[model samples]
Target: MSNQIIVTTGIYDAIKETLRRKKVSIHEEKRLATELRNARQVLRRDLPADIVTVERKVTLKDHTLDFEHEYIFVSSTREKLKKNKYSILSDIALAVVGYKVGDIIDWPFKGGNRKIEILKVEAWEE
Candidate 1:
């Protein structure tokens, strides 16, 4: 993944609030801080359709395990215990958000760093 990331203003504001109101791991805090610094905030309509953001459905492939996962990235308040919904504060979401389909990154999963590929991005529907 590139050093720079693009995010909608809403998601950007949510992230900033999350950082202030919630306690996260030091690594996550730093990672998010860096992302905020390098982020290019834009209006939702101005964002590209392929980019991943909160409320979007994303399909990801784990290169090392050869596994596929699907998730709907949601804001913290909107997150649920459902299997397919992931909070933006989650490690996977944090690593993938602001990125677009086809981007790959090495993320620190529960086991260790895994090579993950963003396969698809779908807009959310209410």
Candidate 2:
């Protein structure tokens, strides 16, 4: 998936607010800032139901590592990685927006690149 993503307007304000409130390091802040500005905001109802968006439960598999993880894309206020919730401000942008079920993500991980395939997209909730 491309770095540029689409964010539903319903969650835009919440994400923006969360981004402003989070006390992230410079590197993380920069990544979030770039992704934030690059996002194209649209109405929640107009957004494709199949696409990954805030509050959606996503099941992804790292093909290279042969590992899978399920995460709920949520605003910072609701983030709890221990509970599988992921914050949009943390640059899990691909897992949160634009991409749809069965889409493969070629995002870079710690040292090398990893391909992640979206297996499922449960409906989003507030």
Candidate 3:
């Protein structure tokens, strides 16, 4: 079961914001990216291997726009948990955007690979 990975602009903003608050230096961006990448690789390595698929869709409601994608979790590493643990899945989700369904993606980590999916998306004007 091959999963689909969804990436959106908002997720990028969140990562940037989080990193900014943490005072991640410009040089650290590469390192952070690498860590994120490594995390995904770790997940793939530690989790069960499966082929998950994904679908992307756009929605309009009440003058609002939203995007959503769905995929399946094949590996135990894909499972969502509340506790903050250092894992590929978690790293990818935090670093990358729209990580919902299941899709294999390459993270910037030194040499990291991730399987992620974009579960949902929503856009609103402030």
Which is the better candidate, 2 or 3, if ranked by TM-score?
2
Candidates 2 and 3 compared by lDDT, better number: 2
Best-matching candidate per lDDT: 1
Clash numbers, per candidate: 0, 0, 17
Per-prediction TM-score: 0.84, 0.67, 0.27
Candidate no. 3 TM-score:
0.27
- Ranking, lDDT, top scorer first: 1, 2, 3
**Model 1 TM:** 0.84
Q: After superposing candidate 1 on the true structure, give the runs of residues whose Cα lies further than 4 Å from its correct spot.
A: 109-111
On TM-score, the candidate that comes out on top is: 1
lDDT of 2 by residue, 27-94 (tens): 54555567678877878778777678877888888888899888788776788878778875555643
